[model samples]
Target: MTTTRICVDPVTRIEGHLRIDCDIRDGQVVDAWSSGQMWRGIETILTGRDPRDAWLYTQRICGVCTTVHAIASVRAVEDALALEIPLNAQLIRNLIVAAHGIHDHLVHFYHLSALDWVDVVSALKADPMATERLAQGLSDWPNNNARYFAEVQSRVGKFVASGQLGIFAHGYWGHAAMRLPPEANLMAVAHYLEAMDYQRKSNQITAILGGKTPHIQNLAVGGVANAINPDEQSALNMERLAYLKTLMDELQGFVRRVYLPDVIVIAALYADWLPYGAGVMNYLSVPDFPRDTKGTDFGMPGGYIPAADLTQFHAVKHFGDPYFEQNVKESIKHSWYKGDWTRSPYDGETVPEYTDFQQDAAYSWVKSPSFADEPAQVGPLANVLAGVASGHAGTIGYLNTALERIGAITGSPVPMAALHSSLGRHLARCVRTQVLYDMMVENYQALVANIAAGDTTSFNPPTFPKGEQMGYGFHEAPRGVLSHWVVIENGKIKNYQAVVPSTWNAGPRNQNDARGPYEASLIGNPILEEERPLEVLRTVHSFDPCLACAIHLHDNARQTIVRVNAF
Candidate 1:
């Protein structure tokens, strides 16, 4: 058997720099490597800074998922001080998280990864009437009209005729692996354009509550910086609450009538992808959306599910869960770091020691994070599985609906085991989005009711003690389980480390030399064309790799930071 090496440097349509290398044998990937091509040193920058101001700095780690870091940072500091957040503050934070997550998931599916599955060039051959009929049969979305699809087709045709495809320029158009019919392609392309407007509406919910979207200004050490005054003009008044409800209504409508159904249709069309990309199946997620001050109660349940078995789920119940903290360790053995020790994030170190891509040695800047002495996958799949295992009604309900819809489309009952594949990840994300929308509405109503009861508190002051304190905060972020570990010595940050979601998925090899999630997921993935490995991207993009969260650094000197070695 002849083996060929394929390298995709700086994988497009993602957040940061990532390089993927695969060895193809007999038209299938036999071995793979995932490398984070940059170094993120936010932890080092947080050292010696005021612990109260950590959220402001940590939130700047990634431009896309800024709100997640901010929420996690505040929770970590509050946990360290043993502070209890006000109910209003908790509800407000929950709203921000839920909105941001919905927005992020929408953008990821329609804008980022959808192109890997939908072919734009083929849409030009579609008949407007056929496309409209296809979309209408799937969902009763108002835009499923022949004239509207024809208008979209004309706009896309103009892009093609102008000799500039803009965003659609570099796609693997007309590839043999592209299997959607021309009518289905046209429908998907139309939705791709309309998704931009709906996603913005979802993001507006975050901006309204958090003061801004990219880096929210509402987070503080003990509680949110938002003031609660029902009648006052400048504070959280009824008018603003009503506006939030309106945004939630529009977002929920689009998600249910368009986003969820679109994903199910695409999953049914690409059902062949359902058996691939089930890598590093030990799943880990953390409970979020706290209902009380101490963080013991949650709106969504989370835990560890080993080997995709929901029966073995172990729940992470609170803010500072020992099961989560003690078992989490990052190994730098195959990373471009100083040491080869597998230490907890509480004692983690980040010293750069670059060695150009050695296949069996140091390769990526992403440190392998192991949950309970083994590599575990994180993200919506993990979150949904854990929720189902814990008997969360909302998660189970949405998940079953999605499975049933796919089954109706494909003419076969989609089994639970199918969720361990690439299509499963996509379906799980949509299910999670539906659950999040319900949570958002519930939190909004709770906020309104609490305000009507004459309780208008939204902040709590904090005071650090005279001795050392250690605390860790975990949130089931948009990507997966995001944790911030802090070591405060007399009100100053002594050591800070963030075990981000991307680090858990895109990591190279673990301390035991086992391949990480991204690498392991590509093991049996079929590579139809060695030159244009579109199949390779479908599996990787399913994970929604965000290298900026795993590793990121900018050079002020503008010199070449590192050299790429082609295989």
Candidate 2:
């Protein structure tokens, strides 16, 4: 067998740069490696800076999850100081997070990820009336109808007219995998544009509470810097909620009408995809959505899952909480970290020691993160399963409805174990949306009632009781589990490390040669061509690779060479 290599550096349309290398043997990829080419210095940058400014700086780590990083960073400081933010502060934080989750999902699915499955050019051949039938039959509001469809047609016409198909010039309509008849693609195409506009509105809610986005301000260590009075709380206005409800309504309908069916249509055409990308069964979810306990409001507590029994079918085998350090450890065996060995997150360090990208040697800068010493997977699918298995009411109902919808389309059940691919990623976002929306209502009511309950203030930065201690603050963000650990001495940051979702999913193989979530998922895909490795793209994109947080997509602050066997 002759081997051919395909390398696409700077994976386009994502937030950061990536290098996807595929080893093709007989027209199929026998092995694949994903390299994120940047080094994030957020932690290094915050070392001597005011610990108070940590949240403000850390939020810049990723444009997509800025709100999540800010919240996690501040909560880390608050945990270290043993500070209890006021009820109002918790509610405000909850709102910002939920808004971020909802808006981020809408935008990511429609704008960045949908093109993988939905062919825009093929949509031109779709019968508008059939698309209407799909839209009208759903319980939600109609998707972008005739007028909106016309607008998209004109817009796409302008793009093609401009001779700037750019990346889209090579239409995939003739590909065997392209099976969605025109109208369904048209509906999806229209909503992709509509989702963008609606997502911006939801993001505005975060800005009103936290400041601006791509990164927000005032999401400080001891709760919000901006105070919310009755007027301000009420300023959340029914209009904003209405916008979310409408947009989400359309999204759910489109998922049921356009996306889900599209998945089935494509899957039927490419039945081989069913088994190629299943990675480790280990899964994790950080509890999000604000829940009240003992007069304390906690954003959903973080949690995890392990491969214990297959009969139970995606059941939670193990549970973990805020003390995430016990559950997470990183192995530098195949990464650039020149450490003694795999170290606990609390005791972790990131010093990139570059050797070479040899299979038997160092391949990625991403350290291998394991859960309870296993390669735990994190992402949308994990989020949905954990939410449902944990018995969150909103999540259970959301998942049940999705099962019924997919069942109707497939004429059979989509077993829980299948939550590991293009289908799982999309479904997880819907489940997360439902979960955060429910929390938004619950949290909004709490803030309103707190004021009426005669506690006019929701923030009280208690005088820090002195002690040498450390703590972990963890919660689920839209992408997956997010956590931060901090050790403080003399009211300054002594030791700090963060295990963001991207790191968990994009990490390298461990000493045992166990693959990180994305790498493992990429290993078994069909390559078709050495020059165009679309299958590997499908597998890696299914994980929604976030290179900024992983910081391995070519934006090194400064490169230095250190001699180490691991590097």
- The Cα local distance difference test for each model comes to 0.92, 0.66
> What digit string (tens of lDDT, one per residue) describes model 1 on residues 284-359?
9999999988999999999999888788899998889898989999999999999789999999998989999998
lDDT of 1 at 245: 85
- Please give the lDDT score at residue 206 for candidate 2: 82
For candidate 1, the TM-score is 0.98
Task: Give RMSD (Å) of candidate 1 vs. truth.
Answer: 2.6
Point to the candidate with the largest TM-score: 1
lDDT of 2 by residue, 29-127 (tens): 676676767766566665545567777777778878788888888777776666767666777778888878878777677766667667777776776
Q: Model 2 compared with the native: what TM-score? A: 0.87
Give one clash count per candidate, in the order shown.
Answer: 1, 13
